[model samples]
Target: MDLLTARIDLDAIAHNTRVLKQRAGDARLMCVVKADAYNHGAQRVVPVMDASGADAFGVATLAEGASISELTAKPVAAWLWVPGQEIPPGVELGVPTLDHLSWLIDARVNAPLHIKVDTGMHRSGLRESDWEAAFRMAARAGLEVKGLMSHLAVADDPANPYTDAQADAFRRAVALARQVGLEVPVNHLANSPALLSRPDLAFDQVRAGVGLYGLEPIAGGGSDLRPAMSWVARVLAVKPLSVGEAVSYGLTWAAPDNGFVAVVTAGYADGVARSWQGCLDVAIGAHRYPQVGRVCMDQFIVWLGDNDAGVAIGDEAVIFGAGGVGATELADRVGTINYEIVCAPTGRTVRTYTGGTGA
Candidate 1:
């Protein structure tokens, strides 16, 4: 058995895709599979999404787009790339700036392009001042302008007014693109959070990212989405700790009494962040144990508290997943988001898939 594993449920992915597609209504569902499907392994999840209801795929880099272009016949659009990078064939491009547009035009890139406008995020995409100019330039260059796309800054908070402001800006960009002779068909602006909360902003397509992974983007918003990934480790060893005796580096935590502690296989190097020390609760069978002391590079100690459940070596210890704390709850404990929690399993963490056959 693998010492550490990120168990991915492909059926959950398919279920989430179908749910998002149904929620999208008339708008097309563009499943965002960037960062290897948020570290869920795009190579596998993409097919599940495609088989379910994903109308298209979206990635952050050209390489990522190219990697999964053949996975589905649906359009694959990559939005994050530098100007001089070689554009991959068979993949759509999101033009984030005038310079990127100019580069594409100069190179005569034949890929379908989505003009990324800065509605509110202000991280990437073309500024409002350059929208008209860029639109006209693409029109003049006879580029295949697929549509307009933008990012929502505060879509996670449904009550945030900035989402409304950004939606208005996105509408203006789409209108201006059409005014400048670009058909601007299939424009999209709503991300997972917006797509879940604001159907009004789902203009032409909805890019569902984290939601496709069964994570609710809105805080305190419960949905039918089931989490797909589980970070689990094996109990390497269980030993007794005397009172006043400590465990792990710095001996930051000691046994509250004469209780037992279990050595878990996961550590910081296995994507269990060092900062997660003292905050994580590992679940073994029916019992929950508090992780104590400094997190090591290859292992950590979880106080089993008298080994009531008799957690033994090789027993599966769920760091976060179905039997343990949920990703959202773990994120709340670690001062992060569920997105990062799902994406954290790396290094020695091996990925194992389950429920992919549609059973």
Candidate 2:
């Protein structure tokens, strides 16, 4: 039996995909499976998402795009790539810079691509000053310009005016691209937060990333999305601790009273951030226990106050998930985000799937 495991509910993924698809309305739904579906095992979840309602798939790298390209016949587009990388066959590309567009033209690469315009994100994308020039260049090279794409600078906050500003800028880019003789037909700019909040910004397609995995990007937006991942560890041992006795490395914490502590089989090496020590509340059976002391390389201690729930050595301890604290709650406690929470369970952690029928 694996000591640490990430229980992935495939049904939750399907439900989230369908919900996003419905939210997209007339627009297409592009499921972002980059970072291995945000470290949720894209190989397993991509098929579920495609079977549910994914119109396309997006990834950060060509390799990532290539990896999941065969999972679904739907088009896979990768946005983050260097100039010299070999373009994988059957995967679409997102031209982020004028230099990348020029490289593709010079190399005579014949692949469908989306022009990533810098719509105020100012991260990676062709600048507005070069939009017409780049569009003309792509048109002259006879490059198949699939559409335009942009990233939102601040869409998580519905109250943030930057999202609307970015939307307007993206719209202008599309118009300029068309004016410069590039069709730029299927343009998109909205991410998870924007897709959840602003349907008007969905343009031709909404790239649903975290929401596909059931994470509510907008704080307290309260969608019916179900969280899909659960990080769990096995209880290794239960030891009694005296009031003044300390535990683990640095001896940072001591038993407040004469109670028992359960040693859980997960630690920093397993993606449990050392900084998360003292902020985690592990759930075992029906009771919650406080994670005390310093986190170790392979394990940590959870104070099971009198062992009230009878947590045994082999009992399952939920670090975060359906039964324990939600990923968002744990993120708030650890000063991180739900995305990182789901991506945590690594080193020696086994993954298992459940409920994929979307029932």
The clash count for each model shown is: 0, 0
lDDT of 1 by residue, 9-75 (tens): 9999999999899989999999999999999998889989999988999999999999989788889
List the candidates' TM-scores in order. 0.98, 0.98
Model 1 lDDT on a 0 to 1 scale: 0.91
Task: Write the residue-wise lDDT of candidate 2 on 154-191 in tens digits.
Answer: 89999999888888898899988899888877999999
To one decimal, what is the Cα RMSD in angstroms of model 1 from the true structure?
A: 1.1
Instruction: Mark the regions of model 2 whose C-alpha exceeds 4 Å error after superposition.
Output: 357-359
Looking at model 1, residue 243 earns an lDDT score of 94
Cα misplacement distance, residue 257 of candidate 1 (Å):
0.6
